[model samples]
Target: MRRKSIQNWRRSNSPVLKRFCASIGKSLGLPNQVADYWDTMLGGKSSSTDYFENYLLSEIDSPIVIGLDHVEVIFQYPEIASNFFCLLRTWNEKAKYGNSLSQVWEKLRLVVVYLTEVYMPLMIHHSSFNVGLSIGLPEFSRNQVQDLVQRYGFNWDSDQIKQLMSLVGGHPYLLQTALYHIWQQDFLLEELLAKYTINVRIYSEYLSEQLSNLRQYPELYAAFTQVTNSPTPVELEWEQALQLQTMGLVHVRGDRVLPSCNLYRQYFNVSASHLQEFHPKSGRAEG
Candidate 1:
């Protein structure tokens, strides 16, 4: 049960995830086809909210999960809000009977799921970027994460955690983004002392690398200068931002685009200005 709690919503082994497979199957109306359908879903590797809505939430003649209706509540349709709450109320009741599919279907399972989605992100919010980075690198282990946090003091809040989890779901890129900021801030040096700091050295080394990558990827770097030098800064397309984002040099925040982290921001601006000052003679892009 303890192991189950930590491993919630995480079922890699076929035999191990049998129960979760069974539960999801029950929710979908085909208790026996749980494993079969699950295998197919994973094999296809499709990521569509519509697929989840159809596979996990469509009206079915089977036991419902605890929070299905809450998804509906947040579903963003005014007409569906009342209907979703009513569906949720029924699911809550159906879960209460002596034969309550949910009550004994797995308490540990419920807790595991709660930890997997809700609690994990909440805990991650206040933690160090290295901690979040470690979480992403090591697949998904709740206790390992717990130990990581306890070993190195970190913090989290309810909302930021959830927002990040949903955005990246602990994927390496997104997790790294959040952590990059956190860790970068701590190691960063002010402009005066930064020249002597090892972090600056490392970042300067990294900036050099970015400079090298730009030689082969002019399309990506084109937008960086294009924005600052433009009479009216042009809107960058997603494809144009790939190189910048992948190298951790910049990020897109809504309509506004900026550097990936403060450290990068400082380094990028300083180096760019420096390049303008010295590039042989002409400080103009080659026509």
Candidate 2:
């Protein structure tokens, strides 16, 4: 049977519970009455849950998948995020009753996508995340990177690919961006790698954004600086390490963490130096 899919509801755009319910209602092709009801309910957590359950059982005839993208945005609003996720978990539980109601509840599926780990506290039994199958996408492997390189119409030899990987590791975004620029801008691989610092024109914007994000949390910034400055992996506080790993800034192995790519190390090292130069007493950048 064909499934109905709500491509995504970016929580960042509708963080409020009522707005969130309205977005879902609209996506499900529900009439204005549903949205009006949500607004009228004043976004009561239980009311919103019951509304979705009743609506799906009565109106939705086919399986529907709701995709919640950029879910990390809600992490900033812990109360709402906790209540919202618990509501989802409750719905999932309702699907397992082995009755006619279960059939309707089973028709509703969810696809939640986020960049960071959920650091906010959540009860194990009430979290949808804890109950779902978790999938982690690691950096591309050497062969996978080569396959992508060839697909970009490059006839780069093993040595050239190795050089590129040495600078950016197997990060798909960094690798793809570099390959595209090299192919389209006619830049020689060696020349590009030679100028592969954080200030390089191609990567400055992205690198700057990462730096800005790191600066927001001074402790995380300091922890990451330690990782970047060390030639070998360094052990950090567990939460700091996990947060950095989630930010795609560091790779964590066992109790040790290291910069995710040479690009990060090069950039952050220069940044740290500049911070030391300007703030010699503290040797740390202010958030």
Query: For every model shown, what is its TM-score relative to the native structure?
Result: 0.31, 0.80
lDDT of 1 by residue, 103-142 (tens): 3322211111111111111112222111111221223234
Q: Residue 195 in candidate 1 has what lDDT?
A: 42
Residues forming the 10-long window of minimal summed lDDT in candidate 2 = 1-10
lDDT of 2 by residue, 151-170 (tens): 98889899988988888888
What residue runs in model 1 are displaced by over 4 Å at the alpha carbon? 1-198, 225-234, 280-287
**RMSD for each model, in Å, please?**
15.8, 5.4
Model number with the top TM-score = 2
Residue 9, candidate 1: alpha-carbon lDDT:
28
